[model samples]
Structure formats: C-alpha cells, structure tokens
Target: MPFALYLLALAVFVMGTSEFMLAGLLPAIAADLEVTVGTAGLLTSAFAAGMVVGAPATAAFARRWPPRLTLVACLFVFAGCHVAGALTPAFPILLATRVVAALANAGFLAVALSTATALVPPGRKGRALAVVLSGTTIATVAGVPAGALLGTGLGWRATFWAVALLCVPAAFGISRRPAGADDGSAPDLADEVRQLGSPRLVLALLLAALVNGGTFAAFTFLAPVATGVAGLGEAWIAVVLVLFGAGSFLGVVIAGRLSDRRPGLVIGVGGPLLAAGWSALALTAAHPAVFLTLALTQGGLSFAVGSTLITRVLYAATGAPTMGGAYATAALNAGAAAGPALAAAVLATGAGVTAPVWVAVALTAAALAVKFAPWWTGSRRPDPIKRPRL
Candidate 1:
C-alpha cells in the first residue's frame, strides 16, 4: 500500500486504542469517580452508542470538507476529548467526554476507509480497507495491553494523556498530504439518500451488525468462560487473549487476499465456521485445551468476515462510498452495543456464562441465512461510483 495508507492506519491505531483500552481502565476509573464498576462500564457502552449515532451523522455533516483536513480535524477533536477525559472532575463529565471522543473516532474511520479504498485500484479496494482496519487488530494485540500496563503503573488519567500524545504524530502525518479539489465538493445528499433506500444495502448493513453481534456476545463473557468453564488461571487468560488477537490478525490478511474474488464463498462458509467455533466452545468447555483452541479459531473467523462484508456494503451503496462506509461503522457499533446486553440477559437468567456461546451460535446462524439470500449472492446493479483505473 501507499505511505498515506499507513498514515491512515496509524490514525486508526490511535483511535482504536482509545476505544479498546477503556476496559482495562474501568476499575481505576470507578475508584476515582466513586462509582460502582457496573457504572464505570457504561463508559464503554457510551462510546459504542456514540459511534453508532455519529458515523452517518458526521459523514453527512462533513460531506463538503476536504478529506485530509476532515481527518486532521477528527484527530485534533479526539485528542482534545482525551485531554478533557484526563482532567474531568466528575463521572458525568468523563462519560460525556467518551461519547464525544467516540464521535470523532467514528467520523475519522468512515472518511479514512473511503479515502483508503479510493487510493487503490478498483480490484484492490478490499485489500486497502483491510490494511486500514488492521490497526484495530494490532491495537487488540499490542496497544490495549500496553495501555493497561501504563494505567496500572501511572494512573487512568495518565493513560488518557498518553492516548492524546499518540494522536499528534498521526495528525501530523495526515496534514502533510495534498488536498484534492473534489474532496470539498458538496455531496449529492438526495442521491446518497436514495442509495440508502436500497434493500441490498440495508441487508448488507444488517449482515455487518449480525457478524459483530455474534462475535462480541461470546467475547464479552470470555473471562468467565475461561475461569469457570475451562478452569484456567488468571495468568493463562492473558495468553489466551493474545492467541485470539493473533488469530484475528491472521484472519484479516487471509480475507484480504480472497474476498474480492470469492466474497460469496467467504461469507457463506465463514459464517458457519464462526457458529461452529462458538458451538464447540459451548459443548467442549470442560476440555481446557479445546476451549483455548476454539477461542483462537472463533476470533479468526469472526474477523475474516469483515473484509467480505465491507466489500459487499461498498458494492451495495456504490453511489455513495462515504455513506456506505459510515453505514458499516454504524452497524458494527450497534452490534457492539447490543452484544453485551444480549450476553448479560442470558447470564441474568442464571443460564451461566457459557450461555453466551449459545447466543453467539444463534446469531451467527441468522447472519449465515442472510449471507445466502439470493439478492446478496447476485446483485446486478451497475456500479455508480465510477473509478478511473489506477
């Protein structure tokens, strides 16, 4: 990919770290703000909720801004929110900061995905988007652990400050790019709205949501699954989590290569594989080795669906790439917000932590049905977003 793609990935890394690192800081934040751990956990939910609302709204609102400048503005706003988070005196203010920061993060991701795909040849757009999104996997592998370590040593505030510091370099890298003339043109809002009316596009968005919902429903309860079902020690949990992250990274690379040509194959087979992994976890939880192995496979197959789904949405909303990109983000975040709740509801019924795995299986089955629908298998709509061959 181009140097600019790497810069966009760096921005994604910075923002993704902000999103994932909050889990590790919850205890410290709760203690500092004199709130319960459950309340502190709402910060995570708040961020996801913000992204779900912000993605399409911000894309529509900033449709006329130059892409590079829009990205830079998002970075600065994200950094400012972190700074505010670090200095906030009360819990509500801190919660508000996370929501705003998530808005910036969502806006940046929508624009960055559109820009990255546009920078590449038409056939290479899936690979380009994979490169940009790899930052999230990398963050899971590296940044979140490092942020947790930093939070443990310094303070939660210090971790937020560190995230702010990381944003500076990404912003500078983006600012150096030359602005395009078409970047600031007023987008045809009417046309974009009409494009959103497509059933194919709406189904694609629902697929995105189902994919993430299945993955996260199982993931949110993983700690308990590890301890209660697998009988793993606390230290072993970290190792298992790392294994999952590595699997996710591998999944992205593999999917990037195969999706453009065999998107249908990937979605059709990958969904069932995901369901199977979760089902195996549910059935074989007593076998620690099997549970650990299944965890890695499940993580991989979950992320492996991303490239195909993104490409599908892009094709479905060919008239408005940015709007399509935003729709993807919104769907993913909506799933993120919903998954934990579904898992929690299961656990609330005294079904045990492993209940989530069953929930995951059911959700993945629904996604698989959607993927096999005739409309998705063959959309004859002409590509509206014309591209010059690179």
Candidate 2:
C-alpha cells in the first residue's frame, strides 16, 4: 500500500473522533448549553443526516477534481467546522456546526476510500480499504476516551479544539502526498442512477445498512447498558469501549485478508456470527463480565462483515466506482441513524435497556437473509474478481 493511504487513515481518524466524541460529551453539552439530554443527542442525529446527504452530493459535485484535492478541501472544511463549533456560544450553533462538519466528513471518507483502494493492486483493495478504516477503530480506542477526558478537564469545547488542531496535520499530509492514479472524478448523476438500478448493487447496499444498523442500535446505548443493566460504573464503560475497539481492529485486519478471495464466505459466516453475538448480548446484558465479552466480539464481527459488504458493493457497482463507495457510506449512515431511532423507540416503550440487543439481532438476521437471497446466489450474478481504480 502507498504511504498516502496511511495519511488518508489519519484524516479518517480525525473525522471519526469528531463524530464519536459527541457520545462522551453529551452530558457536558447538555449542562453547558442548558438543554435536555434528549435534545443534545440530536447533534449525533444531525451529523448522521448530513453524512447521508453529503456523500453522493459531494461525489457528484467534486467529480471533476483530483481525489487528493477533494480530500484536502473536505478536511479543510471539516477542520473549520470544528473551530466554529469550539467557539459556539449557543446549542443551536454547535448543532449546526456538527451538520456542516459531518458533510465534510462524509465527502472525505468517500474520496479517501476511492483513493486508498486505487493505490493498490486489484486483489488488495480490501486490505487497502482496511488500512484506511482502521483509523475509525483506533479513534474508538484513543480519541473517544481522550475527548471525554479533555471535556472533563478543560470543558467540552476543548475536545473540539483538539479535533480541529489534529485536522491541520491530516490536511497537510494529504496535500503533500500523491493520491496515485485517482483523479477523483465527480460521479455522473445519470451513471449513479443507473448503477443504483442494479438489483445486485441494491441488495449489497441493503446488506450494508442492515449490518451497520444492527451493530449501532445496540452500540449507541452500550454505556447505559453497562451502567444500568450490567451494574458497571462509568470508568468500566470506557474500558469496555477500548476492548470493543480492539475487537474492531482485529476484525478489520482478518477480513481484509479474506474479503478478496472469499467475499461470499466472509459474509455468510460473519453475518451469522454478528447475529449470534447480539443474541448473546441480549441474553446476558445483566451480567457484567458476559456483557463485556460479548460487546468485544460483536464489535469485531460488525467490522469484519462490513469489510465484506464494501467489497460486495464494489463488485456489484463496477460501472460507478466512486459512486459505489459514496453509496455504501450513505447506506451505512442511514442505518446508523435508523438503528438508534428504533432502539430509542424500544426504550421509550419501556422495553428495557436490553431491547437494543434484540433490535440488533433482528437487523442482523434480516441482513443475513438478504445475503442469502436467490438473486444473490444465481449464476448470472456471480461475484466478479476485476476491481476498479479511483
């Protein structure tokens, strides 16, 4: 893999941290901004909504630009949003900044994936993408916790400042590095529409949504589940998140090695394992030790299945490579938004904190069914081996 790919990973890490750090700072934000916890949570929802809209929109608009230039511009905007967020004096302003920042984040990720995969050999796209996405897992391990700590010590605004400062280095690196052969062509709207029309591509995207939605539905409420259901303290929740992050990294590495050679097998096995992990979490949420163990395993399973899902999308949407990645990002973000909303509904109904676990199971099972659909198994839709460049 090219060194530029790792620089892309650093950019991803900055973006992911900005997104996930909100979970840790919600309480502080709620208190400082004098809003209800529920209202403060909308920051997360707003960011996800922006990402869903931004990916394809950004890809469509920046299609003519080089991928490196697109990525650098996105990072610059992303950093600027954080700086604005850090200086916001009111809740609404902060929320608006999140939306704008998320838009930049979505564009950066879509372009980064295209650039990273294009730098590698055809068979190694999975691993190359993995290298870029590992930044997210690493953020979960270091960034989220560090943000929470910074918020506690220096106020929540400090966390945003830190994210903004980090983006400087990421943007600088991306600007200086060559993005290989990826011209970062803006995707044609007509071509994307035609690509979306493919049943195989549609199914692949649905699978991505389901898996991500399932994983996040449960994960969105994990800290609460740890404290309320499992009887662990706040500190322990951090440790468990670190463990989950470790599991995610492990899954990405393993899936990277297998997705190229055995996309079908990877999904077939990973989908069920993810479902099983959720089922076990549902059954054992009251047991701290058991819940922690299952959370770790579940995190890994989610990403492993995710790696294969992206590979599937690239295979199915061969006609529109950049649009395929943007679509995948959009699908996953849609799931991310939906999962928590549905899980919140379950919570509102007094279904207990463990309800998210069952939500996860159902979503993952739905994904498993989609993966095994007749259309997916037919001879006419055989998985193709040839890959696209950025």
Candidate 3:
C-alpha cells in the first residue's frame, strides 16, 4: 500500500474518534449545558443527518476542485469546528458544531475513498479500500477508548481540543502530498447523478445499508445488554467493547485479503454466520461467558460482511467513480441512523434489551435474502463492474 494511504487513514482515525467519542461524553455535555441527557443526544442525530447530506452534497460541490485541496480544506474546517465546539457554552452552538464537523468529515471521506483507490491498480481496489477503512476500526479499538479516558480525566471539552490538535498533523500530512496523486479526471456531474437511477447500483447500496444497520442495531445498545441482561459488572463493559473492537480490526484485515478475489464467497459465508451469531447472542444473553465470546464473533462477522458489501457498491457504481464513495457513505450512515432508532423503538415496547439483538438478526437475514434473490442472480443481471451507460 502507498504511504499516502496511511496518511489518509490517519485523518480518518481523527474523524472517526470525533464521531463516536460523543457517546461516552453525552452525560458531561448534558450537565454542562443544563439539558437532559436525551436532549444532548440530539447532537448525535444532528451529526448523522449532516453526514447523510454532506457526503453527496460536498462531493458534488467540490467535484471540480483538486483532490488534495478538497481534503485539506475539509480537514481545516473539521478542526475549526472542534475548536469552536470546545469553546462554546450553549448547547445549541455545540450541536451546530457537531453538524458542521460531520459535514467536513463526510467530505474528507468521500474524496479519500476515490483517491485511495486511484493510488492502486484496479485489482487492488478492495484492498485499498480496506486499508482506508481500517483506520475507522482502529479508531474503535484505540481512539474512542482513549477519548473516553481523556473525558473522564479532564472535561469533555478537553476531548474536543485533543481531536482538533490531532487533525493538525493529518492536515499537514495530506497537504504535503502532490496534487497528481489522483490520476482520474473530474467526473461529469450529470452522469454521476444519473447513475443513481441504476437498479444494480441501488441494490448494492441497499445491501450496504442493511449490513451496517444490523451491526449498529446491536452495537449501539451493547452496554445496556451487557449489564442488564448478561449480568456483567460495569468494569466488564469496557472489556467486552475492547474485545469487539479487536475483532472488528481483524475482520477488516481479513476482508482486505479476500474481498478482491472472492467477494461473493465472503459475503455469502459471512452474512448467514453473522445472523446466526446475533441469534445465539440473544438466546444466551443471560450467560456472561457465552455473551462475551459471541460479542467478539459477531463483531468480526458483521464487519467482514459490511466491508465486502461496500466493495460491491464501488464496483456497482463504477460509472461514477467520484460519486461512488458518496453513495456508499450515505448508505452506511443511513443504516447507522435507522438501525439504532429501530432498536430504540423495540425497547420502548418493553421488549427488553435483548430485543435489539433479534432486530439485528432479522436485518442481516433480510440482506441475505435480497442479495440472493432470483432476480439478482438471473441471466439478465448486469456485471457489477460493467455499468451500462445511462
């Protein structure tokens, strides 16, 4: 892999930390801003909304800009948002900063995905994408935990400051790269937008959404499930989370090696196993040892399937190289939003915390059914890599 790819991953690590660290800081933010915890939670929703909108909007608006310039500008804006957020006293202002920061994060990811693939040969696109996405998994493993510790030791504002400082080095690294690193010409915006109407591409995006939605459905509520259902102590919560993150990092690495050659086999084998793991988790939630082991297994299978589905989306949207990343980003965020919301609804029904695990199982099963439907495998189906002209 190219050295620039590592730099891009570094930037992603900062952004991913900012995005997820809020989960551990909501209480401090709520108390500081004189708001209920539920109200402070809106900050997360705002960020996700921004990501869903920003990925395509920013990517389209900056399509004509130099790739390096777009990346650097997004990083500066992201860092600035953190600075402003750290200084703000009002909850509304902090919420606004989260939205703006997410927008910048989305733009950087959109451009970086295409740029990463551009740095490698066609056959290595999946591996390149995995290298870029590994930053996110690593963020889950290390950055988020460190952010939580920092927030606990200092104030939550300090976490924001730390993220901003981290962005400076990433911005400098990205800026030092030559402008010609991205070899592709700017895509035609009209053609790119039109490709959204492609059935094959749409299906691929849906698959990506389903895979991530299922994963987040369980992940967002893991803490409650571990304590209330599994009878684990508070300290064990972090341990299980770390184990899951470690599994996720391993999953992405394995997908990188296999996805380029056998995407079908990866998804086909991984999807069912992921669903089965979720089912087992729900059934055995009362057993702490079993629950902990299943958490790690599910994490690996979930990311393995999710990563492969994302690779498929890239191939399905081959006609729109620039917009392909935007579409994938949008789909993944949409799933992330929808999954947790649905799980919350299920909990509202007094179905217990384990209900979310069942929701994950259903979602994964639906993805498999959609993926292997007769129509999807029919003779009329087009090759994922060969997008027909719109």
Ranking by lDDT: 3, 2, 1
lDDT of each: 0.83, 0.85, 0.88
Stretches > 4 Å off in candidate 2: 182-188, 383-390
Measured by TM-score, the strongest candidate is 3
Ranking by TM-score: 3, 2, 1
TM-score of each: 0.94, 0.95, 0.97
Q: Is candidate 2 or candidate 3 better by lDDT?
A: 3
Please write out the lDDT profile of model 1 over residues 86-149, one tens digit for every residue: 9987999999999999999999998887787778877777788788888888887888888888
Q: List the residue pairs that clash in candidate 1.
A: none
The digit string of per-residue lDDT tens for model 3 on 1-390 reads: 888888999999999989988999999999999999999999999999899999999999888777898899999999999999999999999999999999999999988887887788877878988889988988888999999999999999999999999999888988997744544476689999899988877888998898899999999999999999999999988887887888888898899888878887788889889999999999999999999998888888888888877877777777888888899899999999898889999999999889888899888899989888887667345564543211
Across 177-233, the per-residue lDDT of candidate 2 in tens digits comes to: 766855545457687669998877888889989888988898888888899989999
RMSD of each candidate relative to the true structure: 2.7, 2.2, 2.2
